[model samples]
Target: MKQINSIEDNLEILEPFISGLNKYLEKSRSLSLFKKLPIRDDKENINDRLLEGSYLFSPCGVELRESECNSLALELIDLLKLHLTDRADEINTISDHLLNEKINPHSIILSTIKNEGNEIRKKIRQLNLPEDLFTFFLIYLARPFREQAASYLLEKIEKLIWLYGYCPVCGHWPVLAHINEESGERTLWCVCCNTKWKFKRTQCAFCLNENHESLEIISPVNEESYRIHACKKCKRYLKEIKSNNDAMNFQFDKMYLGTVPLDMIAEKQGYIQESILTVRYDNPAGNELLMYRQKAIKEKISIN
Candidate 1:
């Protein structure tokens, strides 16, 4: 585990939520839920996808047992319930559904869960459950599981690494991009499974457009060090932070939330805050990635 500088003392804006997340993450690895996750495997798995010199599982390819997923989700819900006093009943209901395999955490975060005009959305509103809050809960619960699964495959394949626009592990797009202060190289950070990969500095992660004219860089006047890399081709944006390699302990999850203001700014400029590459590529994982990516491209092309 990497050590992070304490930001708890400075937290007052979203005190309960932000501080709780920081505190929870500090000890998340030690929790029994996280410990139960499978570790580095001695034997290579048959289902691991070998892509661009890395071994990764598809979004649905994580080999976690249903029992394991339920246990992890239950524990995570219990932890979240501590901070979410107002939503205890809703949390309990969520717990029941998760335990019964009636709901999947990954699907929710990946935006693949379609409960529109369903009882679930009605329940969500009735219980005052915010979509972002629910998604956060899901991501936190699923992170350790995905991380452990990826590690198992990476251990067997010594050269396992990815340079693609999408996550090699989960096939999701990066939530943040950062530059290596020393090498000046670029890397994409995946919030889904906490994976990082080197990527082409000039290429757009979304539409894979390499035209410099189509890429616009926006920087906040207050925070000159941070940048919003927006692609004119796809109208999609990714936040970039300047950090040294030694800062591997950077709290990317926390940083991502803290930079919501930047996301808003990007969105106001006609660029999207979310990933444009949500689709699963053509693989055994089916068209999950491909469909999403194609839709994003089609929408942007039509708009322009």
Candidate 2:
């Protein structure tokens, strides 16, 4: 793989993805799905959950009516199709299939398998559809809801979040991590819900293994601000950004975009990205909060 040496190169690689994201954020911001969202009372208490070793509700656990989710998915498809030029024809087919379905967020089978933590690729082998489409749809389709939660909960709990590894709110593992320049404290960043929380510097985010000898740090020559934290036990890697003056000015999303080289290098060394299998709350397709909304659907057919 080619090394990316500058911000321009990173933008070249990430432009397609980032361009669509801004539009998705803007359009979704205007939706009523966020208005009077049904956030369970305890979900907002970030510090409380950390103290008890309990996780806040995953965004998937939040209930927005199906119609709104479907609408968000449809809006996302327009932006997604633009970025997925290689899969344009396949994406069009997926779009058609989605529009024809009465259900929102489309692809119930894939979503169900994803929620159940089943091997989706093997289950959908006969379908022959592009797996990328399914993955993107499942992730971004729920963004509208997740972003809403982030907007509210991030500010609601005005305390120093103590948990380090997984997100306190969404329960998903982090996409990126960074260290404070002064204190040298580390924090993990969640892309799914845009969450940032403090974690132990020496501990591996995946297994919580703090044996310094079992952990490795990979840094490129001349790039003092960025490094890869690899845990030998879990074989999972986290991209870490050191919060220097210049680094502090860069947005986390932009930093994530520019770190493509880091991800490639880490993966080449046999370390996979850090992602935990999100626990299911209720139904096969979404969070347990969907249970209330899914009563009619559940009555129609058994999930198992």
Candidate 3:
């Protein structure tokens, strides 16, 4: 495995992409592009749902207003074209489609949030856009709104009693893990909503496999702070950063971006990166969690 002294070294290697991404992120966060999403403040009700292993936000339950989605999509595409010079022409084409209303931003936003990869691919094919590039742009366009909604919901709830492997906010699998140097506690980070929650150190985040013999942690030589936690039973791996100081200074997003080499190494070793749409229900516990989520979604729809 390739070794690096610090995350900054990795960032230097990915400077061109990182530079463009950083600008996009900064500009996106500055604008009040999204409408204020509804927040459920019924603590007792929330507690009951949490106890039942239900996540706060269901895939289809999130209300991304059409106007806001359209506005944000145009803004993001324009910014992508400006900062990401290599893809200017492609992004400009996407921008024109959004401006002309040939592509419905609202539908695309919903499909992306729901992890409907096939639907996204179909749209890309019809439009003749670059598949991977378009998908990447769409994911970023939807991120800010999801983060906004999750922030609102997070403020109202006092305690999160969720014990499930997937995110408590978005139902997406974790993209990274932070291990406290002193406490040795593992906290999982949701890729979609940026929600954080404590999870079992020995358990597999993908499949919840708890056998010590089946779980392994591997780190690159001379890189003590970084590690990859792999599950032999499920053939899945999660990137981890073990922080020496208080983990407050660690930026999960940057760390995820900086650890591209770890991802390559894990993939080369036959470990699979679990998709956002995948929900593990093979175990009885996982089944119950799924049931609770279904019930929550139904209730949310009925109320709406």
Candidate 4:
């Protein structure tokens, strides 16, 4: 295996997967699917499996057996059932043969750069979930794949959205951030929409707060480069690194991947938000902006 020297290089490894994604996008963005998806409403709520998605955090480095993936898929149906009469026991059963250690629900989502290979995408469609869910599942995948998969899911669902619309994609909300890469041009990338708009990276993305007093930079006791960007105007914050060494041009998506624990601390202080991924769970993938917390997946281990 060769080391990836740049983000562009890593993204290339995903070309085969991205190529397939281009087709999924053209077929998915339909208004009919976005208007009113038929899932159990709050008052009519009766499904048990539906709750699982909200709680579904695909664990890391964990291997899921075909039995487990199928079982979870069954749970997905359970989660999908809008009516109590829906029989996952009869209509939806896990294909015991479909399990593969690679079917990482967590890894799949995170590989925003890598669209699930055809086998996984085919398996996802096999679940027969509401169209919105497929979108969420796709974008919720934080990997670069989400970048394209979310685009495909939204286009399939037929929704009109800007590149940087609010965190409408996962229907999750956003906790805002300010990123200033090299050109001194700061872009506001919504965790949900995958939209990038220009703003003063130094100013608050949420409230445009400029007072140095209103903003605070909280750093870890030991780590010098990493710090939290907190704003008093909106009472929101995000994380950033001002390093002495510029060799590492940090991409936030990849940068924040290993820093879940720090996000927890930021949220605890009420400095900024964490899961402000989107407003609704139904929003198509990649469109939802996400914080580190929403990206948290429990540690998974398949005993089998």
Best by lDDT: 3
Q: Clashing residue pairs in candidate 1, if any?
A: 279-289, 280-288, 280-289, 280-290
Write down the TM-score of every candidate. 0.68, 0.74, 0.78, 0.38
Candidate 1 achieves a global lDDT of: 0.61
Ranking by TM-score: 3, 2, 1, 4
What is the per-residue lDDT of model 4 for residues 53-159, given as tens digits with 9 covering 90 to 100?
24111122323233332333334333333222344343233222224433454444333222223434565567643333444334533423233334433443232
Model 3 worst lDDT window (10 residues): 278-287
Better of 2 and 4 by TM-score: 2
Regions more than 4 Å wrong, model 3: 1-8, 15-41, 59-67, 82-102, 277-304
- Candidate 1: tens digits of C-alpha lDDT, residues 1-304: 4332222332344466767666655554554433333333344452233432233554432233445555556667877788677778767777776666567754443333111113334545755666665656756766665565556545566654453577766666788888777877888887766777778887888777889998988876656557788899878888887777443676677667666666777877998655322334544344454456655655654576
lDDT at position 80, candidate 1:
72
Residue 187's C-alpha lDDT in candidate 4? 40
Cα misplacement distance, residue 217 of candidate 3 (Å): 1.5
What's the lDDT for candidate 3?
Answer: 0.72
